[model samples]
Target: MRELGAHAAALAARRPGEVRLRRVGTSRQGAPLLLLSVGHGSRQALVVAGPHANEPVGGATALRLAERALADPRLTEGADATWNLLLCLDPDGSRRNETWLTGPYTLGRYFRHFFRPGFLEQPEWLPEGAAGAVLPETRALLDLQDELRPFLQCSLHGVDVGGAFVELTRDLPGLAQRVAHSAARLGIPRELGPFDTLYWPALGPAVYRVPPPDTGDLAAAITEAAVESTWFHPRPHGTVTAIVEAPMWGVDAVEDPTRPADPDALLRPVGHTLRRDTERLAGILARVRPRLRDTPGAGRLLAPVDDYLLVGPGIADSWDPDAHVPGARALPLLDTARLTALRLAGRRLALRTAGLLHQLVTASGRDPDGVLPELDRLIDAWCADYRVGCGAYWIPVARQVEYQARVVLAAFDLAGRPTRPHPPADRPARHATPRPEPVRRD
Candidate 1:
């Protein structure tokens, strides 16, 4: 973010006529979250990147978009909309991953530094605190949305492995095609990722339609702070929210939408691993609980991950194997890319859990028996395993960044285009809104 901040400021200086940089909000750690306004227009479009600290690929793209927006205002979906950019939403988390950002962006380095906010701590999770004491970063985004009610908003996100994909608040006409085209132009193939399509069904190839988030303060019984599904809830009707997920590594399997022939072969081991991870994580939590019970912000760091590792499996198991996937195709699942990515995800989760434990024990200042040393060994082992098993396909960083930017333009097109749920009865209807009149050319 320091670099991006410098760049954004520099862009404003260089393009004084087009760029205007301002501090939109402050992070939990007091880092300024910046907003770069690039065009002088009536319609508003908001774009944010780096919502998840671990997913920093979008950060680079956001910077590129900021620069491009200045040179060509139409990139902001034309001069009609005043394009706004939030360079980094999760500066706190993003700073945690910078250790690998500079170089050695190897699979090992990534998992070693991999850290995502526990579910409750995620930016999308709302009611951050008792009242206005909410997370300043999240508050900034919410306030921006309320003020702008943007015709289109996109949060740039990239994945660890598998092909690229997208998520939108609604199923818009030609939007999926545009997403496919933009990604295709970059030589990147569409992928639903390993388990993404399983969880979030697709509206079209490689375009997973995010179900509209409920309009309620998410306070599940699990924790008073937030719930698992407290996603970025779109505030205004007809406002479009989109997310494009590029990946570090990808393969053709992601797009096939095929059912694995030996379902048991892939299902059993992955299932076992999930359950084992859950049990293993629970054990660690139990052992560490008594010691770090009162550690500052422990609940914020602990509860969400604990629930994620433990509860997610039950959700998967409850689904009958006999039932067809909501969007699953009968095509033969021939590639091992998805399977490899799935396993890697578990390993990453384990590494992240171990890392938190190390933090917890050391911060507790009560491990006279050198549990921290033991944790060091455990974390080291996980790292070694992750490194050894890091055999997933890697997408070029440039490719990842470019796809992220192009998808935003596609999202704008979707927002402007007419939409209605049909052809696919499962989708809800989206009435077409009048496209904003493009600013007159000089």
Candidate 2:
């Protein structure tokens, strides 16, 4: 919370007209969750919430955008000309991710544990009738959205490993081309599509459906349900709603030809790639600023293009590695290894379920052994199924595993069977492994 406050304060101080720290709500821990509003005009409203904890880039990008918007007056100007930009919706999550934020070279580590709705093992996503309820952070946003009712709402997210970029929207015109053009300018490979076609295919059609009239306050209801529902569903009410999932690291330029398996060698050029991409993204935004202001009903004009372009193949080429080495697999192996470690960690947590139940039985005099076993079985099953489903894709594997772990942990906590850490295992010692010296290039 202190960290979030400090960052927010810094943002406000740096960009007075474009940034304001507004208190949205408090977390269960009573920590204040703030919304950083940038830009100051009545022409159009743009809301971007980030760091949902696991995905910090969104927060970083949002802050960067806010700062940029403040610095550049044209961004605030529109055809009829006025715009409102809200930055950073989840401060609690963002603050919790301070470790990664403060680290010097921890993008890889951060990407590995990248947090998402289901992955944090949070209690907020659990069903009210079945288990726990929504988190204060999510709830606050729901309330805020209802009150503000912005013209455009975007949740910034990024995948650590993947060749494709995804822009999720139910229906938005020209949003696809604009986003793709923006991505191209930024140098990030991207596509625009419905949420269903990429990660949440099952929820795609449903998300596209127009809400029934009685659906009072669409965005708020959808936000509430999203935070509370057991499954991922699209909210019919948001005027222009979508999630942009960018790749945290670059992907192999070549896909068809298999390459030698060398994770280190594969990632050596990522830094250069990202630097180029950042510059391109900045340029893209600059170009789009004028078009956004000039277009009448900019939100509607942007929607259709946003949907189709995001998912289409044309946008996919932006992030492709400039040069391809034929016969290389082009796999995001580093991300794969990190994701595997996370899954193992989640599995290790399951091992403690029995111990947790025993502790509960000892302390509360309630034997939940039978129920614990059943729950354990269910959790194991979920994890196994999740692993299988996500195994084919590095991004999905990490995402789904994180989600399953969160759900399992929340369920266990709600059931009053909290677990404790086990003592470290002893192992036979051998000669110490030597650290590799840094490689130098002439």
Candidate 3:
């Protein structure tokens, strides 16, 4: 986070005539949320990075975009949009992930330091449930959206490893293909299936457009998931919202477009395992939640894992290979390796469950009792075991950064297509192509 701040500060200093640097708001930790406005244009586009701290790739890419725009405005030269760059919306969380950002990039290492906010607590999912109550960071982003009312906006996002893909408000003609080609050039696979229950309305290869999740209905159930996407709220006028997701690890399964050798049999064992595990977690929760009631911040800490355990079982039942839509069929085969990775994710939720329980007990002003020692020992074992086998599937930092940058540039090009008052290409004439500008090379 310090390094990112330094780079932005230096760039703003170097090109005062072109860059205007200012704090949009302060973070939970009192860190200033910085915004860099580059170029002077009538239409404005907001590029946000570091909304999720673990996804640091976007932060670097955002900086690169700012630098590229400064060096040669062609990146945005023909877009007729001024750029508003939010350096890092969640510095508090970004700082938490910084420990793993520079080191050995391994799955275990990443998860060990992984610190995503409770989904409900994310910067993107905000200002809805609490009657516009928000973190300072979220307030700043909301403020920027209101002020600029940008014609286009993108939140840079990355993933553990799979392939490159995108999330858009709707299918833009030629944009999905353009994004797919870019990822293909880098040997990154386009995620072919419903990546999760979250996204829907798949546009084309590697593109998805999910409607805003129900804030009120979900809040009553999960109590942890974010209630709204900032982009969807206040319903901007024809403003295109987009996001890029790249994997840190390079997986051959993602690179290939083949189904599992035995599609029918592939997911069964994993489903069985996760189901059994889910049951075990549920049983444990029954025993633990009673002891944890009224503990300090324990409810907030438990909200996510509790929701995961409660909701995870039904998730497997929804996985019907035959029911896959066209783009969904393209998803990487959920083989043993991928299933194992999913298991690790479950382990993470479990670890979170135990760790939070430990905190609850330790801080309860209660005496160190029989169960507390037992919890401590179990947590230690999980941590140690994680270090040994967690980072098997890994990608180098340089490759991850390179692929992300390429995708970001491609996205900018696709989004920068001439905007008409009505976005006519969503119709049958999309193939005729929208006017495009000269592509910028990094």
Q: Which residue segments of model 3 deviate by more than 4 Å?
A: 76-78, 127-131, 197-199, 212-216, 219-227, 260-262, 282-301, 320-392, 418-442
Candidates ranked by TM-score, best first? 1, 3, 2
lDDT of 3 by residue, 28-145 (tens): 8899898888888878878888887778887777777787777776755556657788888889878867767777765545654566666666778753642574677777888888
Cα error, residue 377 of model 1, in Å, equals 7.4
TM-score of each prediction? 0.78, 0.45, 0.75
lDDT tens per residue, model 1, 1-442: 8998898888889888777899888898999989888877777888888888888877788778776676675664475777888889999989877877876666555654556777556675554332332667777887777777787888887777556777766666666666666666666657644454444555766666664443333322222222322234443434777877887765545565456677557655655665566576667667778877778867656755675665545533423244454653342242454555455556555666766666666668787656667666766775655444553456678877877888877776567766654445235235443333222111
Tell me how many residue pairs clash in candidate 2: 38
User: Which lDDT values do the candidates have, in the order given?
Assistant: 0.65, 0.38, 0.63
Provide the RMSD of all predictions against the true structure, rounded to 1 decimal. Answer: 7.7, 22.1, 6.9
How many clashes (backbone N, Cα, C below 3 Å) per candidate? 1, 38, 5
Q: Whole-model lDDT, candidate 3?
A: 0.63
- For residue 196, what is the lDDT in candidate 3? 40
